[model samples]
Target chain A: MKKGKWGLIIFGLVIFIVGVTFPVWYGAGTSAPAPVLDMDTPVIKSMPNKKCVEDTAFIRAHHMKLLDAWRDEAVRDGHREYTAKDGRRFEKSLTGTCLQCHSNKSAFCDRCHNYVGAKPSCFSCHIVPEEVKK
Target chain B: MKLLLPIIALFVVALLAACFAWAEAVSLLTILAYTSFLIFAAGFVYRMMKWAKSPVPFRIPTTCGQEKSLPWIKTHPLENPANAWGAIGRMAGEILLFRSLFRNADVKMIGGRPVYGSAKWLWFFGLMFHGSLLLVALRHLRFFTEPILPFVNGLSALDGFFEIGVPALYLSDAALLAGLTFLFFRRVVLPQVRYISLFTDYFALLLIAAIAMTGLLMRHVYPVDLSAVKTMVAGWLVFAPVVPANAGVMLYLHLGFVFVLLAWLPWSKLIHMGGIFLSPTRNLINNNRSVRHLNPWNPAVKVHTYEEYEDEFRDKMKAAGLPVEKE
Candidate 1:
């Protein structure tokens, strides 16, 4: 018999390396750009402070938690008002208050959600904003 | 000290990574990850090459069934493979199902004669650990992929179907932990097993458990920004690693454990992942009867032929009255 099947062994190793280091070649020359949130909506642009209910960093990280809290408070406890960190009062409604400024759901909401593969069930019951369908 | 040493070492490693992360030493962490990966890849190739270069002088397949013989006799192809196809099938069984280990039994002296009892816990735990590790690794593909694989999403949904918590708990997470725990306890709880257990074994288990715990803490307790996690990991894949502003210490600890495991794998028993395929006893076909196998290391011995011997000593044998065929 031959000393070793070098051809077959090398081929197997190549396959293993390729499979294990898939991300290296898969992401080669590819840039994973973060989703660009368009805050150019007329409602947002018209605001004097030009800010969100919470700070940008806080909202970016804990938006889901905030939305969850809002959902429970509005639905279960019938608490419809929210007091912001900046001592501002706002109605705790997705469509009525939150989406008022962020009117373009696709540009503002769907971008990051799709990028991160977050399948939020918000639209399952609530209707998608009219502008989003356009 | 064997147990305590590795535990302390792992703790120190995690602390080092945590400190680096706190200092926002993104470049250092990236360099560490890359260096460890390089070591793993190099060590893998080195070990494989070493194994390949060493020649096997004989067919030494560890057979458990009857070898091929007369036409009337039956042969177990999987257990005693005589052909390439049979060998491949046997290998598949050994790799996927761990066929040999499945038949494990504990032999004890009950009434002076040996008594064999089922010891399938080892096999079960092995399967659980490997199976759950595979699932967890697959689930992590989402971080590497740009758009994220659709099957990954489906797999995640299936794995987290129980929906025990707010973000939903993954079944693999629990299974992996249980598997690690069982594997660890088996060494300490069983006297025979403990006798053979090395410090490295305990170290590997504890390190893995630590990684899993840190990951769980990030997911359930602290709730770190997953977006940041993905961004950093995906960035590393693309050779553009950026430490996100809000990346937590838990993430660093998890990463530290993973890096250490990667670097240590090729040098440790974990190389069995690759070594399983290269094992001569399991991989070689049982074809000694049908074919000739030359020993590569056999020394060349000078032989004196009968004809040559007779030619040299024919006259002397004839004079001495000894019978000679040549004369």
Candidate 2:
């Protein structure tokens, strides 16, 4: 008995396999080592608490939300002060507050952002600090 | 109730994942993912091969319009394709745009008389659901890709173009939920559909809904470390699987549900995804009139020819005074 349309059948099967198992082939030899974030900035070293506005885990997961909220509050509503969980007050400014300690943008922000391919438009309007230009 | 069973089963599955996640059994989850994927892939291939090997010895294309014939006659190329390319185009239209489903009709009472009217809701929601699912699946390429593909990035940008909410909600996610809601409610609300629905129907829907809900929980309600998620996915893709130290309970639940769906897909009605392509009625070209196709099921038999019959029965026919063709 003749097999039904072997050419079309094989083509369809190949497409299905290639499409479903795309990740395996695409990342076959790729090594996505986690980006090593640097916390050795002069401002970070001089900090008393040596902590961010939130805990490490919270910041790691939701720093984008915090930054977005800060942008809205500071620029739109004129509320520049953020009250942390521990009653510590922080100025809700990315460049002035967050970037002061993480001044080395390439080392601090760019690492994880590049690792995950997140191209946030923070630097579109705001300039990278001149101090950390080199 | 039939509805209650799938919901309860899904809940139990979720609870199982939650317990495992609570115990930090990430390796077990990884193993399950790998095993489920292997089963899904192998089963899918086996099923497709079975379909491929089945002999369809007839040009049984479901023609809906005038077939190609006499020079003066008009023919619908898509509805009744005469050539391979036309058939392919028809398949593309059916697969991508659901051309046939778009022509769905419903019977309803109008002024005490039965009337046939267009019922495009299933087509609409089905397209929405499948389209969004495709996009959502494509969006996950970022997790597996070391350097994310530009097309995936562009797709993500388009999906999250609205920039609503923190973390930027993907429009596909919302559309997927809306589609699922409409589809689920249609089964529950329409008595005709509800009567025909079975356990697997509700199970498939609920399982997907659970996956989506758990994913949303992780994204908005309880944000997980995305970098870790990406790392874990990348690790799996590269064959050096690393269980994230803190993949969170929601991640496991979401991923566990997905693995379950994958494992169940080939063995369930979801195989229609592959079956649609192989369906003879849809894929075959209506060219039986133009070309001869021998049915393979027809068996060859030993034949007694007229000459042989005449030769054998000539003596008997001559003796009985009946006319014989030959001596």
Please tell me which predicted candidate would have the highest DockQ against the true structure: 2
| Native contacts present in each candidate (fraction) | 0.36, 0.70
Give candidate 1's whole-model lDDT: 0.85
TM-score of each: 0.90, 0.92
Q: In candidate 2, residue A88 scores what lDDT?
A: 94
Cα error, residue B167 of model 1, in Å, equals 2.2
DockQ of 1: 0.46
Summarize candidate 1's per-residue lDDT along B48-147 as a digit string, tens digits.
Answer: 8888877777888999998887878999988898888998999898889888879999999998999999899889998899889899989888878887
Which regions of candidate 1 deviate over 4 angstroms?
A: A1-4, A69-97, A131-134, B108-113, B305-327
Candidate 2 positional error at B217, Å = 2.3
**What's the lDDT for all of these models?**
0.85, 0.86
How would you encode candidate 1's per-residue C-alpha lDDT over A86-132 as one tens digit per residue? 99999998888888899888898888776776666677677657656
What's the true lDDT of residue B299 in model 2? 91
Largest TM-score belongs to which candidate? 2
